[model samples]
Target chain A: MMQQEEKLRVSTEQLEGGLGLVAAAGYINNEGGQAIADAVNELVASGCRTILIDLEGTRIINSIGISILLEILDRLMESGGTMAFCNLTPTIARTFEIMGLVQYARIFPDRAAALAALGRDG
Target chain B: MEVALTLPLVPDVELIAARAVQVMGRSLGMTDGELESVTVATVEACLNAMEHGGQTCFFVRVNTHREDGGPSLEVEIEDHGVGFDPQAPPRTSPSRILGCVAKRGWGLTLIRELMDEVDVRSRPGKTVVRMVKHVGGA
Candidate 1:
């Protein structure tokens, strides 16, 4: 059997003076979905409206993970806040496109672009 | 034709699902590809049962027969547990209780889409899922 990789990590950094950085690493599946959701919720609760989800390290996402993401987007949109994704792998990128998530959310190539778009200092 | 199976309400639920679809599909003369889809959907249903039903034992009854000379199968998955409301919308955010990461709530929808008929009942101490699949679009 293929080994299961380490799933997720969340870290925060002060950026653009007011904005906060939330970086996520690893795969998103039934095993890792709850942790990711909690991390995102933590960021939102910390008064971070302009959210930047750094997906440079995430590799896979199952349906459960996608639902969590859509939930986050719905919550943020309801509050008039913004969330952006960065450095998505091809598989995940294609999934986002197929789900039409990119239509409402912004995608960036790297942290610099994401922060710039969010008008935050990185 | 009918087949009765009792399965442990653990990870082994998928095995029962596969067997149910296989026996019923064969009785209905379904193509290999069609049988595969039914098997996948049935397994998903069993997983849902295991996840949602807080029970120790589960049972599955497959009732297969010909309707108007076309093959059809109905599978009843029953569990003895305190059932939850299936009509309520699924949680949008990840559930800490389930401890899963990917968050699409399409398990039931997929089963419904794959099958011809889907019925559910959640009583005080038992939950039953009834699913039917028609062969050859008949």
Candidate 2:
């Protein structure tokens, strides 16, 4: 069996009000999930308290990916930080709801809305 | 149309199964939502098979069929693993919900929710999960 290359891309930007934006694309399996965790940790290390993930380009995620997100959520909770998700595909939004991640993280329809809800200037 | 693939029990290979479902679903004229559900369900099924199937290789087969009402997509994932009872209490949604914070055990639940029909058959040496989604909502 040929190894399928990991395709998830993660990038972060610091926004006003100490909000950090992490954008991800591609499949969020094990490799993609690890990449996301690393990105969130990096942002947190830089003193960003609130984070919003833009998942507009992400289409598919497995249970492992969800686990990674949960880890990030736990980390944020420990530090009195918050995380939000924006631009979730219909399926992904439903998955998050089912997994109960929505209880801990906020989800918005778009980046602007998420940033606004997080009290950051869009 | 019909397609079959044999993949190693590995996490990254889930992409191949997902892409196959996507392409076949498009060719079968599935709506975007329907296609997305099928693809996700397929990948979830593959992931489960890889993690729990306890086998080195698993098989995925996809086919389109015309039922009495409309066309439907069917996918089957099979593996030679130490199969568990589908009727087991741990498979219930309540148990899964309780364990949500653990970030695991949602694969089977997600597959059941996303697919129109699901069937699981398991024995000591083999396990097979078959799922179907009807097109056109007939």
Candidate 3:
């Protein structure tokens, strides 16, 4: 088999309270990391802190993907912002816990709950 | 459309993994988290290929097929590298994976847990991993 890498699609919605709800759906592997990093970076550039990543539509994520999330978390923290993850399945949630990601990012059951925890609804 | 990707073994692994997940998930109707799982597991497998396979060029190929009588998706990611025994020993806990931090070991454990089916073939020259996940079900 030959090696292949590609990015599918990413978009974000502006929620209330300056919170940006970014939903990145697709694969995240060695090949697909840059696009994701760029997506998160785009959110930061828009001056929207308090980011919520909806993993409900996401199917895969590699270490590089984790690095991107970590970087985003760092970016948010540096700017006095926050990041939360929602729609975590058993498998995905376990991966986050094992990687010590839960130490940095908060996990929610879904998007509405995450937003509510952010103290807003939009 | 089934796409194959090849990149030089380098430090930028996650970027590639995300791209693959995008393609597979969109085509198969997988949710965001599911795509994340595939990308993460694929990254682990690719890292193993580069490190253990001892190959200059790493290969990642994905093939998607629908279930015959069910509503689900199956994707297989195969690599061309030296493979290892998947059944060697279960790491027992995720902490062991974090504590050791070995590229191949941790990723393998995570991949096994994330995907419905994880298969590894570690021959001398060609190491392939066939991973399958079912969608649209509880």
Candidate 4:
């Protein structure tokens, strides 16, 4: 048994034109994934149609975490919302590609780029 | 270099082994993308074992040494449980169309894609996933 805080820190920000940003930092393990999923789900449930997840501070992520993201992506689509990601590590970006995630959710270089893609320059 | 640990099947137990992956990789000169790749693949292997092992605990072993090409690290996770057929294809894929997402089954896929080499041996009563990542630029 080991005592460690493999916690995921999550925050939400409202951007222009109904775009919501959910930023997550830390390992996206099972617990961390759930926390992020919950945050995004809340945004979707709150009538937000566009969302971006920032992974700047995250260095490690597993399939459980990816699966959670895919679930949230599905949820967003089902509700006519959109999901995108920014600040992904090269490894994560490759993983998303291999797992066919990028085919569905768009990936931008960073938050600013993602915002610009959504036409939210302000 | 070599290290091994057994984890009791608990929630987020993979973190313990993930720490081992990091410590070993950094100590053995793995950096940046390769280190991150190995760490994540290790976590995915541990998660697969814990999810399907049907056992109280699972094992993780890390070893690093010079290979024919260069230095490399391999992480092996083992569990004694109801193993599945290794020949069977892993069920994973994000649907191109909206409203359809296969949320699960990406663990094995990610491991195979991230690591330089991957081998999974499984059957009833035991399962082992070995993932190898080459050090330095590859």
Top model number, DockQ = 4
Model 1: DockQ against the native? 0.10
CAPRI-wise, candidate 3 is: incorrect
Q: Cα lDDT for residue B19, model 2?
A: 82
What level of docking quality does candidate 2 show? Answer: acceptable
lDDT of 1 by residue, A25-98 (tens): 76564545566667767776777776777876664444456667777777777776777788886546655664
Better of 1 and 3 by DockQ: 3
lDDT of prediction 2: 0.82
TM-score of chain B of 2: 0.88
Residue A65, candidate 4: alpha-carbon lDDT: 79
Give the number of the best model, judged by TM-score.
4
| Off by more than 4 A, model 1 | A1-122, B90-104
Q: Compose the digit string of candidate 4's lDDT tens values, residues A7-109.
A: 7789998766888889998888767889988888787667678989999988888877787787777777888777889999999999888777788788999
What's the candidate order when arranged by decreasing lDDT?
4, 2, 1, 3
Minimum summed lDDT over a 10-residue window in model 4 chain A is located at A1-10
Model 2 regions more than 4 Å off: A1-6, A120-122, B89-100
C-alpha lDDT score of every prediction, in listed order: 0.67, 0.82, 0.65, 0.83
Better of 2 and 3 by lDDT: 2
How would you order the candidates by TM-score, starting with the best?
4, 2, 3, 1
Error of 2 at A14 (Å): 1.0
Q: Over the stretch B11-83, how does candidate 2's per-residue lDDT look in tens digits?
A: 4787788888888888879987888888888888888788778878999999988878888999999988888
